[model samples]
Target: MDPTLFSSIDFYQLAKREKNAQKRIRLLALAHVKEGKPRDEIAESLKVSRSSVNNWVRRFRCDGLEGIGNKQRSGRPVYLQPQQEELLRNFIESHKLSSDLPPLKGKDIHAFLKHYFDIDYDISHVYRLLKKLKITL
Candidate 1:
């Protein structure tokens, strides 16, 4: 597990633009590891946990160049399909056009998704999904 394996054009570009101290330190640790420095030496020089060094090395092994970058994973992916998303959007749009529905509420949409999709997601997640769909509410 050497940083040489992680070094690529994209990795250099990321290293140049990267500003966070923790991320920079992580990258530097990988660089040292690629240069054949022992983990204990790298940890001492970077003033970080040896475990952190091992974790980043493992990530490099698994993801290659992109592994050095932070990933956006949080929870499991939502099970909804694209059609389901479209259906939700159509439902919201129809409600808006007819004015038959009450004012849009986060709780309202959450309940709707629960009943129709049988999946529970937070109102905040719904809000972000709506924003991504360019739906203003």
Candidate 2:
């Protein structure tokens, strides 16, 4: 790869200011690249693989510093559709208002899901859903 660096940004200053460790390393790598360091040397000195260094450099070439930061991952898909989620949220609210019972636990929510929606979520995922929906406890 050609020794390429963006002239517009001061990567060393960015590296010094960066709080995230991985981002700091990426900025350091860019600073090295700006000083004409070899990819192998950047990788070795940065304790990352040469392929990783090359990937960062390629990203930098394409989109400057913003490209080298972590890309947002498409995490696991939602189990329920938006309408279904709205239904669930509304159900919980009405249930809470009408009933004198304590806050619903994960298993109660699990039972509701299985009985109403015919969806069987893992217990952990039931809690995750609760957290995602901002349903307290």
| Model 2 TM-score, all chains together | 0.81
- Estimate candidate 1's alpha-carbon lDDT, on a 0 to 1 scale: 0.78
The ten-residue window of minimal lDDT in model 1 covers: 3-12
On residues 6-110, what C-alpha lDDT tens digit does candidate 2 reach at each position? 766798899889989998999899889888989899999989999998898789888877888888999987779889888889878887887677777788889
User: Residue-pair clashes per candidate, as listed?
Assistant: 1, 0
lDDT of each: 0.78, 0.85
Model 1 shows how many backbone clashes?
A: 1
Off by over 4 Å in 1: 1-23, 30-38, 51-75
lDDT of 1 by residue, 1-137 (tens): 55454554343345567887667777778778766799999999989889989998888798875676776778976667999989989988888887666777888888989999997888898888788788765
Worst 10 residues of 2 by lDDT: 1-10
